[model samples]
Target: MTSTAIPSAPRRSTFAQPIMAGLVTALVGYTSSFAVVLTGLRAVGATDAQAASGLFALTIALAICAVGLAWFTKRPITTAWSTPGAALLAGAAAVNFGWNEAVGAFIMTGVLIAATGAIPWLGRTLAAIPVPLAQAMLAGVLLKLCLAPFVALSTIPLHVAPVIVVWLLFLRFSPRWAVPAAMAAALGIAGFSMGRADAAGVMGQLLPSLEFTAPAFSLAAFTAITLPLFVVTMASQNVPGVAVLASFNYETPWRASMLATGLGSSAAAFLGGHAINLAAISAALAAGDEAGEDRSRRWIAAVSSGGFYILLGLASAAITALATASPEGLLEAAAGLALLATLGSSASSALSDPSSRMSSLVAFLIAGSGLSFAGIGGAFWALVAGLTLRLLIERKRH
Candidate 1:
């Protein structure tokens, strides 16, 4: 008589692979853009406590979205705060009503973004923004930050040279680590130049304090902060982010993803974070082969990254202190190095279509000009200028 054999269960995949990938992705994402966020917050008049709260809120929001979306969609749907929007804020002077107004504008922008996902026409209208015009506007917003490396070299050659050299070397060999390495080197230089005592003040409020500034909305805040921010976040950050996921053959639920980020952004804005959207640069880190050979399992990588981001949020006090401790030029230098590749790609895309050259150039120039009228920034004007030029050219041809 033969005995029946018992069936064995399948073994589960190890968590190490995806967890490592997630750790790397989280590191790259935060190191590359946190400085820019801090700079933007300061520029918009957020106080030390407020900035820390914003950072804390932004990190936690992104963590939740990244994990929740990846779990539900089974796609490596990584989320991020808007780097371009932060840079745009960094360029603009504080609004007349200050950070409270800015926070109100942030809330409004989040609502509009959420509406885009819920309302078909709004989403399509934003999607229909000319590719050249969007690229030009992003390039224009980045131009000033991209120039920081050169400025650093000229002004603080002794302190900045080492960071530049290390960045260049890594950029050639290990492109992924280049920006973080450079940022570390810059902070090191700054630490040596300015003692720990001076830097300690940034950590004065070590415990994360949620300073709730009741948002006061107005036309000026809407025009200056909300519109420009929403446009760039959608056009530059979210659009390319979708493309990145598609490159990996993930059919991302675009509307759902936008809804997730919009909700996250709205929550974060309550504490002073500018905006959070889909990540552009770090998306590949979590979605690509580097995350794992088995594409089906890569979603775990995003989930892991989200877990780490939550940890980072817990340490916001220390991180903000370090950012505040560093010299302004050091931060600028790091931001410039981080954005150099993006600026090049954006410029190329903006000028790629010959037929749209004039309009694209107009957009780029207006955005780069840093002109503000009636509290509206050059970014909005840039789009208007480009669209008007295109319309005029069409009329003349007809």
Candidate 2:
């Protein structure tokens, strides 16, 4: 036997790890805050079908944006709907503008986002907005939603207790899955409680469908919805998303990312979607070490995540149906649980700097108060009050 030289075994492909990470990213991103999104859309006047359309549109839009950006830049650039923006909408004081005008506001927001990247001065102006105040506004916007779980506990103890218990258990054991687990429990309870008639109705409309609304603009919508939404999305999502990727040594193509998200948001808005931007929290799943050790191939994780998002988008109708059918406050409780961490982080950051403490507190209170005046929402007033207070304080110090 002529010294038989056996071929070495083939190296196992490493693609599976990153792909799995991408799947996790999509799952966590979708499950954690989707109730908030639906709630926000409904609050802003979207009908059930419309809200489902919005959710589906947002999921598909961001998924496409994430996949394209990752492939084009060869980087793990993920995208997400602005969870903070949704909270802002959910918390907004009742406005004069209806859903069409809100859609118009969404369009305007997208325009502003695009302009921020395309116009250097505009970007700087947005960047110049005090970080503490922005964070305060965010904390305020998140306050009510974060309190829902506690409020629900008092009202529906028997039904809500199990969901809260599940959340707490997972929170202590596997923190990352806590909110998602709570949402699953809430959905399970909701499904169990559904009468046969309700079940039949839901089964008939399980597939997602799109509903288009022609945009209508107004000063009230601009001031109350568009401006605040733009700031929240930019401040909370896009900027932090860039920072997260940077922490992983990945350089995001800023202008391109903004343009992509801006355009995507505008498109999704037509379908009643609020807004889409870069992924901040979920970006880590696709960009960080969890994706893989091969830095160069990490983009595949983002691409895979986009694929999963597309699949999730298909179930928007069913998810929305289940969420809407839940016992009053149950879904809100789940949404609140999802937002607690964010509320804590935002509150901590807003109060961190002593010099800005008073101003930040003012902003937080004003935003959380649900105040509306002359057709403008509390969010706009919160920023104004906070900035004015800051200016006065600075002038006094000087």
Candidate 3:
């Protein structure tokens, strides 16, 4: 008899990791942007049911954008419900214009995104931004998730703290599977901590459901919402989105990606979703060795994510109900665990480069400080600070 050594299994990225990241990040994004989207929805006389439909629209659009972009680029490009864009639209459209105007503004931003992609000058200008600056922006965008685990710890000790410890240790050891593994562990603990998740509604609530909402458009809404949405989606989201792909050595066609983002945003807008843009943090997971280096094969992950998003969209009501039922700390812990790798990568992206070290440090500090001005997010401010510092340093060297 010939003895054969057992072969170790090669890994493919799991549904849980990406899904957890998606779900958790979406939760964060929604919380951040809902005020705006909600105000706009209510201003336009949207019912709670109609608002739910908007969420479904957002999820569906995100799924398609992520799938399409990832398929075209062989990078794990994800499309998200744009948090910053929502904030802009909220302030602009809340009372001044209705849904029609909001949709019109959405359409305009999409046009702008598309036009910029189509135009060589603008595309090239955006492309010319330093990779480090882009990475710093990426880091700034993810700052909230990084701190969430600890935040959960103070509130839900029986659940969040132990799981966080396990997650941190696993990350130090396993790196790739750490997040999913730790999260799995946490949910098990949550069952115990929550003291009757069955009674509290964990199992029954996982079932999916559907919702629908009709659309109405106006010019006033467009005027109020357009500028702000454009700024956040482009500056806070895509700038770093492209950079995250670059940081992982995946090639990104800046113009093509921007075009895709524009198209996706428009597509989502029609469905009542907020502006959709390339995902900054989670893309790292799907693009990494975890998702497989063979670009042809990588589409599987994106395709899977798209399918999952659609499913989430279909079951938007069910998802909302489930999330609403869960303990806030438990959700926070899961999100924190999922983001640990992305957070580490973002930190390293800024710190690893000697030439841009000081600039990146300044960028991280400014962004992580939670400063906001003129409705511009930390990512934009961080980039400005980094660029300014880099320019000054260069001048001194010269």
- Which one is best on TM-score? 2
Q: Candidate 1: where is the Cα deviation over 4 Å? A: 1-12, 94-97, 202-207, 394-398
Q: Which ranges in model 3 have alpha carbons more than 4 Å from their true place?
A: 1-55, 66-112, 165-177, 181-257, 269-305, 374-377
> What are the candidates' C-alpha RMSDs?
2.9, 1.6, 8.2
Largest lDDT belongs to which candidate?
2
What C-alpha root-mean-square deviation, in Å, does candidate 2 show against the real structure? 1.6
TM-scores of the candidates are: 0.93, 0.97, 0.60
Task: Please provide, for model 3 over 82-146, each residue's C-alpha lDDT reduced to its tens digit, 9 standing for 90 to 100.
Answer: 65454333223224445555555677778778877799787566556666665565565456645
Q: For model 2, give the 10-residue run with minimal summed lDDT.
A: 389-398
- Error (Å) of candidate 1 at residue 21 is 1.0
lDDT of candidate 1 over 208-240, digit per residue (tens): 666677888888888878988998899888888
Model 2 earns a TM-score of 0.97
lDDT of 3: 0.59
